[model samples]
Target: MTTSTAAPPPPPAARAATPPEPPSAGRRRQRKGSMRRREAITGLLFVSPWILGFLVFTLGAMVYSLVISFSRYQLATDTARPAGLANYEALITDPKIAIALGNTLYYAVLAVPLEIALALGLALLLNSVRRGAGFFRTVFYLPKMTPTVATASVFLLLLNGSTGAINRGLAAIGIDGPDWLLDPAWVKPSIVLMTVWGVAGTMVIFLAALQNVPKELHEAASIDGAGAWRRFWHVTLPLISPAVLFNVLVLTIAAFQIFDQAFLLFHRTTGTGSSDASLFYAIYLFEQAFRQFNFGFAAAMAWLLFVIILVISIIQMRVGNRFVYYEGGDR
Candidate 1:
């Protein structure tokens, strides 16, 4: 009773009134959500044409072919009749399939390494040139721009048995040149030579890779008393190994699917070439589909080729990952 009663304290709700939300934060959240939605829509719209084309043309054709591979598709009647594993079984039993596959493997093994080496050499040469590099690059890349049909025609003339320019040049050097197109032993090599002509594309790829290599690394290596060869082997090659791996894979696949040049050079009415040496898998597949009307078998062959390419590519990537160096520290 010594003093008057203290003023009553404020209520808890009045003392702890909730703070209003920051107006800018709520607006920012809304803006971000709207922006994301807009970006997603725009991305879809940009890719719509490609998606439609792929679904209608590529994916649809692939599915139809897969179905046909299980049936005996008759182009004459425009019909497909189920035959189960017969087409697949024929792949195992067919001798021509084995032969064609062997030839393809041989060509891939021979051509891929040669093309890589030639492309790398050309790239190094172009990189070393201080003058007229652009002109030389254009001249070199001209072969890649030349149409396949035209290249085949040119090679057909150049690889002729007796009077070709290649043989004449060989004769001038006191070396006997083999008949490139006509002889069984030389048929694949002839194709390999033709394949090398268009390695301008591969060269350009390597050139870009070489240009990307940090000059500082080269200088550092040089400062460490590294010679040219040592610098290339240790520093330059590791940096460009990815490009090498890429070109090797692409060239190998192309070699496996070797078709146009072989067909143009050696195709006959019988669908057999000089001793079947030039009867590549693609040629055989084309013959099965078009000439023999074995659509089912051809489709099966196409699938088989695709599987082989897929498996080989996977193997290359697995092996390449071990050696290929990326600047981003990713395999």
Candidate 2:
């Protein structure tokens, strides 16, 4: 009875009362929050330059151009006056635009497949070589590193109709070489040849893709009595389809934007060639923007080209997804 009476139970409120958090614990939490804020500020500071550059140079310019496309822009006066869709109307009415677009399409059709084929062939050859492989690879890739102007100059000499090495070689073989640069039929082919010379880059891509193909698949195909042709057609081609599609898409885009080679070859301080065969879309856009000072028209042309590229890219990607094989599975 004395022990029971020694202490009464504390009140429920007192029993439930909890001790306050330590002052050090509160300070530590505040320090953690401050450290997080500092880290966020540091990250923003580090990326600020890139953000500013992109906004000013890329996005700002794009927005300005878009606005100019809907106006009559005079570069001489640096003025842009609203003109509605008049600039875009020219795209439909101008025959030169059609001709330029047709030429670009033709070049893309010819160059893309040829580049892919040649690149694949070279990649296959390089992949098969065991000795002097690195040397051969370097030798083949050197053309891609050559300056475009220098390459165009050398090709200008090599493609001379009357006395160039190419025609001379053709004569030696008892065949006549076409006037590559002068002839309308051959101008694009000449460009294609020049483009193929730089196929070393695409070839390297294909070579990497080919090398990445699991050797075990090939060995298994061989064990299954698959012939060389069968193994290549079934096993090798599927594995490399993604690379093939990628190269084709890239080459197609480059082909559409062909300006330098055509300009250097067919256009000069004098004038464009007799035929309009070499007047690519990019060349037309340049002429509109710089030569004619029709910035509005040039902007329209740029937007049109952008739309075409975007649509074509979308189509290619959609089509490619069906055929391209990912290791894990299609995404």
Number of the predicted model whose lDDT against the real structure is largest:
1
- Poorest 10 consecutive residues by lDDT, candidate 1: 267-276
lDDT of 1 by residue, 1-331 (tens): 5878889988676467778999998999999999999999999999999999999899998998999999999788888999999999999999999999999999999999999999999999999898999999999999999998899889878988788999999999999999887689999999899889999999999999999999999999999999999999999999999999999888888999899878877884343348579889999999899988999999999999999999999999999999999989999
Q: Give a tens-digit lDDT track for model 2, residues 228-274.
A: 99998999999999898898789888988998888887776555453
RMSD of each: 5.0, 6.5
TM-score for each candidate, following the candidate numbering = 0.91, 0.86
Off by over 4 Å in 1: 1-20, 268-275
For candidate 2, the TM-score is 0.86
Q: Which pairs of residues collide in candidate 1? A: none
